[model samples]
Target: MHSAIAPIPIDLIPSWLDVLAVWATVGAALVAAVTGVLIWLQILQTKRSVDATEQTLTLAREEQEQNRELIANARKSRIDAELPKILVWIHTQTRKAHDLGVRSASGAPRPLTELPAGKIWSLPDDGASELFISLTVAVSNDGPRRARVTLATSNNSFLLSENEQVISVGEETLIEVRRKYTIEDWAAMSSEVGTRSIQDVLTLTYVHQGTEGAIERWVVRQSGSPLVPVPGRQNCWQLGPFAARRGPLTSLTAEVEMPHRDYYSSMSDLTVLV
Candidate 1:
């Protein structure tokens, strides 16, 4: 037979032991509350640390962008300091006329000098006068650096002396262009004189240094009125004066003429020949 368990009487239990058990339970609850508070504080600290890191990163990015801009501005300043400024103009003193195999009444080719004053040679078939005017165009460099210049024109009417030349600072070089005009062309231009003008655009490509394939280009537009009948002279006409200016190639059609300042103030020794 199994023996039955005997139960102790409640009054026989110790009073101090019950009190100690209650106090132990209260201590465990207090420890749990403190642990939860510590965990919450740790979470708050971690969030603050993350926010600080993000702010640091953002500031660093802004600083980097500022530095990049500063470097770019410095580089642009350096390039501008070394760039060359070129000026172009017509050398009015070098203008001369030439004959183009047109015979006069004597059945011989007439020279320009023998032609009657104030009269140009006319084409035999159309009675249209032919004006062969040769003039020198000056390309002057007023900047501090030297430049290698190449001149080109799409117009078939112009004949350039040479395509390329190296120009030094404070020096000038000449490019001769032969201009031919027929009487019909001149008459049309004469009608518009003082009201409008004709212009021809020439491309000027240049390079400051000898870097391969590094080139800068500009457009030179030369404008003038056509030949007008010389006053008080029968059958006589005079070639009108022309002016040249440099401008950006992109604005070729809308280019405004820069002021006509004397570019030869420091370049007195350079002689221009027709």
Candidate 2:
């Protein structure tokens, strides 16, 4: 019976070899596909790690910037706290006399450009006219310690005359003088003062040392009455007292002005002298 085994078929041998070749190709392709998939997954994981690290670094930088800003603010606050606070203020700008004036050195007429057109004012022999006034002011120290008042400047535009520009806050009333009708005219103008209010504008600049440093203020004037005691003589009113103040200097216009009238008139004196 062993000798009866049939011999292999020569034609079927090629078919078996072809099947083996096909299985070998399939196994190699599967290995390649698995390797490629694993490599792609590794690349994705590396990208995620890099992205996370970058985001963390960015957040850290932002936090660091915030901390730096906070530190700067704290430092500025400390500096501000360490600074000493001192201040000076204007107390009162009281009127002393109303008759102050100015004129050219020569007794002639000078056309003022500061005033309106066709306004020709005469210069008195004493350089006095109805363009100025006499004033006194009060000032105060607004600081914990003592401060010094040093310099003062005038802000005279139209009626440019001042006697005492430098004034103090503590000791006495600072008195200044200049152009216009005398305070004696107050009696004559009392009636007019009751009905209408008039004024003259003046500015005073003061330099002082304190926590807030040097400051400036306007000294203004308002009066209702002026008398033409002399025929056609003009009188400018003095400013109200406003120099005395309690605390620091306030931000205000303080626009007090004297009413101006026609200085040059052709009318004759009609009122009988009392």
Candidate 3:
């Protein structure tokens, strides 16, 4: 009865399998931690890439707009410079045709570029209708002489409007001219005046002389009808009356009277005639 049980065999204990289980658990935890870190790094990189791309696009658009504006301004300058030269040439040709007694059905549109710098023009809406031209003249004279300018316009296509006290010859000396016209009805006015319409008038007082001299005012408009000389208020600028028509082709000649230059202009002084 006192017989002792045989001691369990140490070699039969499960040591290797338990050790393998512990090693596997530690390896799996290490792998999971590494995977989480890699995922966070990837998300941060993706956000930075997106932000950089947006910034690049914004800069490109701004550059494009600036280029477009520069191109527009250059084109406008070319147009302004060439317009006056062409107007003057057209006027000369029109006069030649008239003296030779050549009749035209629809008179040619005078080249706007040939217009003198001292003159200003009001053109109609170029896209929809024919062009309309107007002129302003400034003359400085001492004794008394005559000068002539020819104006060619499409019959019934041109208008004479007023620019008030705009031409300045010198200090305390200015020329003011007003356009005389009757609006048949203000209610009948168009809301939009195009290049074909007399939409606006520009007034400028160009300095033609200094403070001292005898300067006489002259009329600046074209008329087919003979000019009737009338007494005027002292030193007041005079303009011929205009008869407007709706349709017809006609050319006008202006006979200007200017006195001989008694006041010599010095090179140091600035003279802006155009």
TM-score of each: 0.47, 0.33, 0.26
Candidate 2, TM-score vs. the true structure?
0.33
TM-score of structure candidate 3 = 0.26
Give lDDT tens digits, candidate 2, residues 178-267. Answer: 324434434244335342333443444433332222233444543443222233655322232223333222211123222221111112
Ranking by TM-score: 1, 2, 3
lDDT per residue (tens digit) for residues 143-181 in model 1:
878877887764334544467888889998876655566
How displaced is residue 270 in candidate 1, in Å? 35
| lDDT scores of the candidates, listed in order | 0.55, 0.40, 0.32
Q: Against the true structure, whose lDDT is highest?
A: 1
What's the lDDT for residue 266 in model 3? 33
**Candidate 2 regions with alpha-carbon error over 4 angstroms:** 1-17, 85-274
Worst 10 residues of 1 by lDDT: 247-256
Which of candidates 2 and 3 reaches a greater TM-score?
2
Candidate order by lDDT, decreasing, is 1, 2, 3
Give the Å error, residue 38, model 3: 1.7
> How much is 109 displaced in model 1, in angstroms?
17
lDDT of 3 by residue, 1-274 (tens): 8999998799877698888998999999988989888988888888888788877777777787777667655544443332211111011212111111112356643333322322211122111222222333333322122222222223232323223332222212222222222111111122223333232222222222333222223323333311112244221111123222222223233333332222222324532112
Number of the candidate with higher TM-score, 1 or 3:
1
